[model samples]
Target: MKKILLVCSAGMSTSMLVKKMQETAVKEGKDYEIEALALSEAESKIDDVNVILLGPQVRFQKPQVEKVAGGRVPVDVIDMQQYGMMDGESVLKHAESLME
Candidate 1:
């Protein structure tokens, strides 16, 4: 299974997105382990995740996250519009694209 981690300022806001992404993954028959974490927790969690997605609010921290990720996993920022709309399908698609 693919392990997808979503990071935000406090990990609270992205929890909703995680839920939606989980639902979308199930509906699409995609086997993925989706979770949310605070940016501060990302460094420790990076080794275990297949991809790291940052919430728009934390987009500025991409460089820090990527450094922790160390190119072992793909890192991408969630689009502000899609995130605000809670568009799980698009977000999931974006993640999937990154994995590719």
Candidate 2:
């Protein structure tokens, strides 16, 4: 299964998105592992993740995340509008693209 790592400020709000994405993935019959963690926990989780997604609230940390994630993982910030509106399908598509 592909591994997706999500990072946010407190790791609370993004947990909701994580659930949505997981539901979307399941509905689409995609086999993957998705998890959400606080930005502070990213370093420890990076090694196990195939992709890193950032919540808008933590967009500023993209560079840092990229640095620590090295070149092995794809890292990008979730669209603020999409996230605020909780558009899971779009986010799931974004995550899927990273796998390619």
Measured by lDDT, the strongest candidate is 1
Give the Cα lDDT of each candidate.
0.93, 0.91
Kindly report which residue stretches of model 1 are placed more than 4 angstroms away from their true locations once superposed: none
- Which candidate number has the best TM-score? 1
Candidate 2: segments with Cα more than 4 A from true spot: none
Q: Kindly report the root-mean-square deviation of model 2 from the true structure over all alpha carbons.
A: 0.7
lDDT of each residue in 26-88, candidate 2, tens digit only: 999999888989999889989898999999988999999999988889999999998998888
lDDT, candidate 1, residue 38? 93
